[model samples]
Target: MEERLQKIIARSGLASRRKAEDMIREGRVSVNSETVRELGFKADIGRDEIRVDGKLICAEETKIYVALNKPRGYVTTLSDPQKRPTVISLLPELGARLFPVGRLDYDSEGLLLMTNDGHFAQQIQHPRFRVSKTYRVKISGRLTGAEFRRLQNGLDLEDGTFVPDAAMIDEINPKSSWLILNISEGRNRVIRRAFEKLGHPVLRLIRTAIADLQLGNLGEGDYRFLKGWEIRQLMSPRRQNERLGKPWEKT
Candidate 1:
């Protein structure tokens, strides 16, 4: 079947459509050994030889959904230029190339989603879904009364003020404090940065849940295929709606 080159790249999970176009414009993409810089180029997936950055890409048609209990040391990206260990290393048995739905900071641990379905990935990660993420955090010192009040109201970071959807001091040790927070946005290092801005440097951070999905007893460094209902609940109406819109389901 013929498709836009950008669509092909995006579907392969190598980059989003916009980024794919940029890759083409930069002469980073080649079809059949010829560098293609035109945005309107189309290629037949069954016959054309397509390569991104000199690496041949086999476009994935089968969608696979997976969840992993990410440990603290692994970065969430597929590959890092620094040669750091990534979450992809944890799923060595995975046959399909899966991309992380959203990133977890290298030092933070917990529930993470990986998949090959672009639409599902966009749906969950896009801000439109308003998916809530829960994190349990430990900070280096007990929260001062003013800091606690400020956190409860909102903490002003230089970049932005984060008013957590829910914030609670779970416990206070003499030297440290344990707290939990729920937030709908995926701002970079928001929890840690927010705490630091409030004068309590974060010692540990772990995401325990995403929306209603819990990490549960899934041991660290383990992954499992999402069940059908789990997929439906997370992906929601997008996948099913598309299938019903297309006639291939009847065939």
Candidate 2:
């Protein structure tokens, strides 16, 4: 069946669909020896000889889903231009190309999902899905009652409003405080930025869960393939909402 060249490349486990589109625009993808740069171009996956970066494409027979307890200082990318270590380095050779579902900054650590299935990655990463992500954060100082209420209600930041599904103080120290926050938005550096705006800069941040999937007992730098039921829970928005005890109206 004919499909967009980017989709074909993504299904082949070469890259995400968005990355494949970027490859097309950069004139790196070719079809039957002809370079195709248009985003609207389509081709038969079975008939056309699709190649990305000069390698022929074929759909991966086995889709891989992994949950990695990403440690700090590792980039949540397949490759890093600066030569820093990446999450891909921690995984064994599974014989299939896998990419991170979302991102954790170089300094943040915790549960990071990696997958070969482009559709699955898209479903989890896209903000529209409203998949809740919980984080255990350490900030510079304790938040005043008013400040805590603001975070619970929502914060109107320079970019957009960031409203946590839930927010609470986990521990209060003399010099620092710990908090547990749950949010579904995927804005870059959102959690860190939110705390910084409130005069308490984030000292540490660790994502503890994504939807119903927890980082339970997964040692740092260790990775394990997701079970069948876990994959289904992540894929179904209704199921996720049910587990979170919240109703999400599709926008």
Best by lDDT: 2
Taking all chains together, each candidate's TM-score versus the true structure is 0.70, 0.73
lDDT for position 82 in model 1: 91
- The sequence of per-residue lDDT tens digits that candidate 2 reaches over residues 30-137 is 999999999999999769898888998975568999999999999988788999999999999998889999999999999999998999998999988888899999
Model 1 CA deviation exceeding 4 Å by range: 1-60, 237-251
Worst 10-residue lDDT window for candidate 1 reads 242-251
Error of 2 at 2 (Å): 27
The parts of candidate 2 lying over 4 Å away from their true place are 1-60, 242-251
lDDT of each: 0.82, 0.87
What are the per-residue Cα lDDT tens digits for candidate 1 across 55-156?
A: 887867677888899998899998899998999899876678899999899898989999989898888888767777888899998786667778868877
